[model samples]
Target: MTKAFASQGDLTEKKITFDEVGRDLWAFTAEGDPNSGVIIGDDSVMIVEAQATPRLAAKVIEKVREVTDKPISHVVLTHYHAVRVLGASAYGASQIVMSEAARAMVAERGQEDWDSEFQRFPRLFEGHESIPGLTWPTTTFNDRMTVYLGRRRVDIMRLGRAHTAGDAVIYVPDANVMFTGDIVEDHSACYCGDGHFHDWPGTLDRIRAFDLDAIAPGRGGALIGSDRVNGAIEATRDFVRSTYRPAARVALRGGTLREAWEAVRAECDPKFGDYAIYEHCLPFNVARAYDEALDIDTPRIWTAERDLAMWAALQG
Candidate 1:
């Protein structure tokens, strides 16, 4: 089944849509690829999530130019994943904002993560040579920080942990739109490689508390209506729960990693087999869930070599 999906070749790169949510807020998304949020302030612009490389982010920058030539003053990182960040320097934002926890994560494992992810998805980081180094945050904050886009208020909050330890959601108060970085995916697949299985659901609830009218998830289409927004959130929560629960149940029984992996494959494959990166993500997802079910809090680092060994052990 995994081979079948790979045979379909990579998902074609789609044109990014600059969907207007409110006066100056726009959601820039290209299929299930990394998304960026554009907030036009009175004097400048704030961009959320820098694609993957400077070359990749250049396209997003092009879109931002269409609206305003205001210098990109701030680049807000929702988390410190290689795909989500790394491209930040391209924006040349005066200040790069991130959660202190995220900055710490980068300090601890940024290099390993960069190597691991580059090996996993070569196509996403096509211009890998163009990357100078791991992106470092110039400014770090704890809990929540609010920035005004002139009169518009954009609240960057570390609303619990879902995708990674230092995850944030951008809330546009006047527009009632939230840019949830991998916390909520629409019809696209969910990447649970380094996730907190036990706490992800509760974190989703925390995100829902914002009562957003529209949301731009980490990937996939922009959720337009309230029902669609709620639907996307529920779908993401369900995907995480469904993927983790069965694996945890197997682990509690003292099952081996292979057994836990098989359990998840059997349960999720039938439903999510066709989703992008299902084959790539399942091994890491099961491994992390198995560790968490046995009381391992911090997930072990995944190197390129380790990724291959785990995949062979689980699915070879």
Candidate 2:
């Protein structure tokens, strides 16, 4: 072990911000850390993207309590990631909602992902022992599902794959606000450990078609205006494109994995080096980009052993 694993050295606590993006829509952002969106309706609330654990989620719970006493009736997982879905139990939402693809991923590799992410990001999993087990969704939808929070409509749609096979977004038509989980990041590195790089740009195009006034991205501060929303989308698209294009080109030319990694670092580091988790995400991002460029459609499951191996290969 030459260098620390993903985000292991990132132990400094980030400042969390709970910004009201709409009348009842809130974004709980922690600098460049994972974010959670809160939608308060007439009588109840819906949480999007749970934190890493119950103890970590309690911070968000405290924020939720400050604004409203509404019971969290629904919890929506934008994708099947340990850091995003494991804290779902803390909300105690009766119906945990996600896409059918996400449910399958959870069933297939949820435990492995949990262990893998815990090792990669120990700071985020402050209370790893508190996690009862793998979080499972109570309800699953194919393409889209609309849930009413007392007349407020929150449309959850799987608008193609970017971050994962089952990446979904929560769109509020009335509020013109969209909650994109890792699909559109701002001033942060997009973790492409399990991403679909080839299809990600098209997904971003689909998201751009929406008439959104504000956006609550998975990381970074909430985008407040339409311009900022568009900027975030473009930034995310650029990051994905800049990262994958060079690696894919290297792979297409039958270059080695290290060559692909070097290509990406040479092209992207100048622009994205200062972003959070840039170093942590580089190897995995390059690996996926290399695979996708070689026509591998689905992302392979990431295990703890694989994480170490990949890190050692790239970093050592």
Model 1 alpha-carbon drift over 4 Å, by segment: 1-11
For 1-316, candidate 2 gives per-residue lDDT tens digits of 4777788988899999999999989999998999999999999999999899999999999999999999999999999999998989999899999999999999999999998999999999998899988888999999999999999999999999999999999999999899999999999999997999878999999998996889999999999988999998998999999999999899999999999998999999899999988899999999999999998888888999999999989976
lDDT of each: 0.84, 0.93
Question: Residues 119-149, candidate 1, lDDT per residue (tens digit)?
Answer: 7777788687889999998888899999986
- The clash numbers for all candidates, in the given order, read 0, 0
Relative to the true structure, candidate 1 reaches a TM of: 0.95
Residue 148 local lDDT, model 1: 81
- Candidate 2 lDDT (Cα, 0 to 1): 0.93
